[model samples]
Target: MVHLVKSATVPEYASITGVSLGLKDKVVLGPFEVQFIDVDMYWSRLSFHVNGPDGPKLYVVGQGESFVYPAADNQYLNITLTWIRSDTKTALIEIQSPLQKLLSGQKLNVGDTINLPEGFPQISIKLTSTSDTQATFLVTLPYGETQTLVITEGSGGSVRYKLGDVYSYSNYVYIHLLNTTSDGPATVDIYVPKVASTDFKIVREGEEETAPTTTVETVLVYNDLLYVNEKLPITVDNVTYYVKLVSTIPDVAKVEVFKDDKSLGSIILRVNDDEPKNVPNAPIKLSVQSVEPEYKRAIIRVYGPAGAHVIPILRPANLLVKIDASPKEMLLGDELVVVINVENLGRGDAYDVSVAAPIPNDFELISMTKTWSLKTFPAFTNMPALIYVLKPTKVGEFEIGKAVVTFYDDTSIETNEEKTIYSPVLTGIKVYGIPKIEVNGMAYNGTWGNYVTATLATQSASSSPLKLPMGTRTMNSSRMPRSSSACPAASMAQLRLMLEP
Candidate 1:
């Protein structure tokens, strides 16, 4: 005998049975021989009651067969099942839509159509996965009436959905990450290419929330601008991503990266209108297209993840020189000593310093070399005295010419600088010689002779004394004659007395 326990629509449970009984007459028979019959039973079919577009519908599925039901977008359906017999069984169930399909442990690909209900457009699906064998699915616009997608099997998956017109000026990109792993949470990294470090800010999409703070790593720097790579931590899965908004060839500048006074690498970037662009990593060869003009302004920016350092290009050395001659006044044939002082007044060191002293026509150079050479001239310091021994040949006063100091810096050999300084002139040089004098006079003696003769002369050829009369008293007076040609009155009186005595 078979029995039905419950119906498909009714909530109450009831039962019905079919049986065969045999009896000859109505006799009150006592305990006679009795027998019991055994029967085998099984469920024939499985009935599924599903809510459809118009109303509820019924579907019957046998063993090893599947039943697919249609569903609206984002709508839930109530399902009920009824078995024909009391035996247990299994059936395959599927829910499909015009734009998508949901099945048990199955994969779908391009050119596969999702049978949705009427009045709906089929949407194409594309998928890709990365990291830890996980897959990220993407649903993009259809390409040439065909949809392509990739599905990966892994511990986790992600989905990125984008919506906008193909030619719209303003468009948007949406990213969605899904974590299928049984672990607590999966970590994901998002990368956006070709963006600057300071150009864009990150924020949550479609919500009044601040996105996680990102770490910006400077990959390279050109002309004071930054080329950067950003790292973001995606804490949750199946979350959409959106931008908040706001995000070389010429060897014009050379950059050297240093840490703790150690050089790491170097690069050269192109300069456009005094700005550098398109710089790469270290160990790169910079093109020396042209030399930078002297005194032109240039800058090198060196940076990493932590901080940056700047070096300004400027003129390295400034030289100031002065020359001096001792003993301003001297004889015509006297020797003059000249000293030159070369000082460096700039911030950088001066090298290969050479000074050339002026050799005037009136002076003769006694020094072996007129030019002096020094290895280096330190900043704000004077070099050793550059001495020149010269003899003056002319007697007239003359202004000494300037001395030139030429030097280069440590940066390059081609660069050179010069400075000139003038010395005080030589003056008041005189010529001197000895003079000769002669005198002759007549003197009178007292008793022997009325007048005596005296003669005085400076002998040019030999030394001689003056002669006078012997009989006259010796003429003595405190005052001397002014010249040999003139005789004083006092000397005559003394001569008369001498003559009388």
Candidate 2:
């Protein structure tokens, strides 16, 4: 609505708008003239300043209003070859009423005079922020078919801006911070440390006070500056000094920092002054040396701010054992010999280490030995761990899950002590049973047509060169070469031999 300020006596002019003013008198919806859309494909969403009618303005019809042919005279004039889709879809080409047509940051109306900012192009309409910065208002206008007002800031740098009949949301914004303030004549350090994204905007402090600062929808970078009177402290001769400064980014931002040419690292963050930290572990050391001005920008600082490093370790246990047995995998009523092995997995030697085994109901122990070294079994390797052996006479799964080997050592220390190394062990086992192999899949007249024995077994963990099984020659196969007599499993090298022509 536009009110003539010329005199209070002058009646307030209803915005010659369809929604705000009365159009019932001079206009109706009878369709004497169709809405026109001209040169839309050539100039999409472009606005044209049509000189409105001389007398009262024509208003567009809206919801709930009755229709009729516009009363007498062509008050709704512009009947030309144009593109307008009336009463069907949203209007793209707008026909704003007269009043808003003249607003230039103050007030206006159709035919009312408006002074364009000096140096600003008269052909282009634009708006400026509180700080006289460019806008990125990518919003759709609302109310009065459409509206365009030229926003201005006395005289300074500016960018293009289209007006709106009604204000609403637009596209995202971007902001940049440049250091410039009476506070800065010295080096002002700003640390961003972290951020979400970087498309933040700089809003003139005049308005937009409620806009977001740091959001996932935006990005921010800090711009700090050192001018005068600001306490920007620097250390020298083991003493602290201060300076004043001011920093700015066209937009608000948080500054992340890097120095010299590498990432010095983030500022040390502390939750509280009392939290016991282990970063400064007893066995490690960290020191910071006094630095010179030539290296003022150094990330590795030397001074009162020097910090320590701490290593955090938790109590650990690693164990393993391997067992040996006689007549492995025993059968019912078969006598069996078993061996058990255990080891200490501590940093210090243990005491009172022992061995354990489950006694099967049908087995009887004829003899047992808890101590066995190279002297007990001179032909085999002696690992010198806690070992035990027993003979059994029954069947079923025998477990030693409850066996406990106890020991004591200095688990804690307040003074220097010798570092001790104990081998952690994998407790494994070997059992014994007899006649456990099954004989099946018998065929008559097979191969040599003779009775023979086959001994099948898996090899040791040691990597000894594979040797083919030795066998007596059969009457029908006595002339085969050694390679073909009996071969080891077809490994990588053997596969190549078999594939050879």
Candidate 3:
């Protein structure tokens, strides 16, 4: 109808509809469509649409951008976003194990995963972070097992993860036989940390597995701590022998072998702490063959936990007695002072130390008692002297006999030790007697017939009776008044006759 109807101009406007979705949320499924309709001009346009049982649209959200997606009815959508900033903050991830190279101080960014190398048995690792910032990571193991680990910041940030339970870092004991005989009874000495008890097995070459032998007796030895020294007796078999420990490093034990009881030609065997992985039920084997000289023996050692020590048995004290006599060359009836000294020259203390000094044969005891007692005698020190005074009664050459010292050790066993010391000989004294003499003399004149007066005197100042009588002996001298020349010959003859005895 060409009727004069005026045409109206229509305005065009752009329309946009959006749906928000999170990366962590489930994807939207089912068919959906988006259409554009213009009612003013009766024109419709479908700008974007998605059909079928799939999501309507899928898109990724970049950094600092918002994303939207449609959610199901009556279900609250929970979205978790792990935003990794482009900042220059770095972290260190360290993987610690025995077989792999140490990943120490390895720089890493956020959301980066550290792959550890394959290890024997199974890999177990200790992870450490050396950064002050919190780090979040996802670990995927060899078997596609995944774990989310959050390592906190600072120097104390560390984590230990076990990939499988088939691996172990425990310590084990290996018994090595250097010179041994199969099917023979043997005694083994093992030095270990103090523990309850240990079970082990003895094996030789080419034999079937057998039950283990447990050590029941343990002796404590002194070291840095109380250690257990176990002595085990076992019979060698035809299989490989192994020593297993219930604990690990620092608790390792030692074995020793001696050629004889005197510890000569000895050798020591030990399992080093760095002897690879010490898996349970598997131990290092050290086999030895027969040795030369016919006196060699094997001594096996196994230790327990660390910090155990062994105390040695106490040793008996050694006592030494010494005696000294003053005035060694003394006369009879002289006082002699004899001193007895007791000394302990051993490592241990002596108890009930007693010293006895007996009286000599030719001497008489003047001082109180001859026995001395000491309750305790310290090692390497001397006790007080025991003095004995004696007087020689009748001595030619008398020997002061040994001074005996008897004492017991400070241990509970109470071992006894004794020592004897002999003194020097004492010289005898001499006796002197009074002198005795007899004198016979007579005073005479010229003639024997003539009357004469004579006087006799003794040589000593004190008067003593002579053998000839005390009274004066008179001899007659008839020619005493004769002439001097004639009296000389006669006087000489008379003097000779009167002096004759």
Candidate 4:
């Protein structure tokens, strides 16, 4: 049986409890400070001044009215005037930071690690190094990449990924320290992405369609505002659904939902529907939350089937292969060292891994394995370097093809399917022919000074030497003036000579 768990209607962002303040009184809430600037007796309204990372702003709202603070800022913030005193001398307000949070009751030692969401390992925070009052955290994010964050007590740091939106930090992971000690644990709080998971069954061809699997997990495919005529592509269980707002009439919206670009069906929804409606012939449910007819936009929540929307709760091995060629510029007959590094940054091991290194046409393998395989490579393991040497057979600019790696995902042992990934192509490899030149010079003593004869020769600087037709060469020597103390008769004579090569 499937259970429906409704998401919390409260704002996902953190909020401060209600605070009452009189005129000119200030209260610090998280990273921002709110000051009761003034009161308007005639209008039954109150004025507030807010100062935060986005800078200061003034807001005026009547009792029970709320206004989004930092209107000029990209983040979403809501400040509400919950209540006002009868005499208009003071007001009660609440502040919400839609993109940030302050976590509490988290304590960690120097070598402790914190996994966001408590158990799910999408992002990990490791306290690698620390001092009396400061600590450095190595944050390993998804896709096998890492970032360093250094923070002290009463401060915080965050890692933000690109979601191709104006407010890119909306879903960032944050870490804030509450207290710290040199030899003991540090108190902290962690703020990660707001993710909700649902469960469903994994139906097979021959088995009953109600096979339950507690291992399966689901993700929020789409939860945002969709504008009129805007086609939003949402992928669930490897199949994409194209949802478009056909049009809207007053409080009702006509939506066209398609499965794989093929028309599934059309549906009509009224603004602020209390319950969600299912799309025709699809394992998806959507509800029209609100509509702004003047703006031609609507806020819709899309949910995929519980079990079918699996996100691989079991970690899969992520292999990162890279090639590095040293001495970008080299000469023919010189050896180039090529190093292929393979790292498994995922949480699962890889099996039957094979690597195919590249060798350019103009280059010949000196010594090393161009292709190799491994039975198993564990996760978070940095394999030893696979080194190779090559000698250029021809002189010119060349590039090596990308390396190919094939491996089996340890998480999918039941399927035993093989996955292939390619490394980036190595570029800017230059080679030049050797330069061979010889010079000869002859000198003879003269009456006043010495006369010197020099010769110039030319030859092809290629693997195969080329000869040219014989030609005549000339050498000229100009006479030097007599020494200041020497007599005029002892001056040297000008000399001109001709030679053949």
In order of appearance, the predictions have TM-scores of 0.27, 0.18, 0.26, 0.30
Tens digit of per-residue lDDT, candidate 3, span 236-351: 22222222111222324333222112221222233322212221321222211111112122222222222223223364577777777777765445688887777777756777
Across 1-501, the per-residue lDDT of candidate 4 in tens digits comes to: 111212222224544445667777765533456777777656487787777777898887888888775673555557788888766466777655564343557787776777666444356677766667776777754323356777777777666542211112322566776667776777767775332111112222244434223332222344446678777776666887878887776778789998877998888988656446778777776666567676576766566654334222244889999999988998778899999999998756788898888998888999996448877786668877888999988877889778899988746675877789899999999887665544534333444234433334445544433344444444443443234444234223322232221
lDDT of 1: 0.35
- What's every prediction's RMSD, in angstroms? 34.3, 29.5, 31.5, 19.1
Candidate 2 vs 3: which has more lDDT: 3
Q: How good is model 4 by TM-score?
A: 0.30
Top candidate by lDDT: 4
Candidate 4 runs further than 4 Å off = 1-313, 369-371, 411-413, 440-450, 453-501
Candidate 1 lDDT tens digits, 229-300: 111111112221110100111235444433333444554544322322222333111222132323222323
Pick out the ten consecutive residues of candidate 2 with the lowest summed lDDT.
492-501
Regions more than 4 Å wrong, model 3: 1-312, 369-371, 410-501
RMSD of 1: 34.3
Regions more than 4 Å wrong, model 2: 1-326, 370-402, 412-501
- Candidate 3 C-alpha RMSD relative to the actual structure: 31.5
lDDT, candidate 2, at 62: 29
Error of 4 at 273 (Å): 52
Arranged by TM-score, best first: 4, 1, 3, 2
Counted clashes in each candidate structure = 13, 48, 38, 1
Candidate 2 local distance difference test against the native: 0.25
Error of 2 at 221 (Å): 56
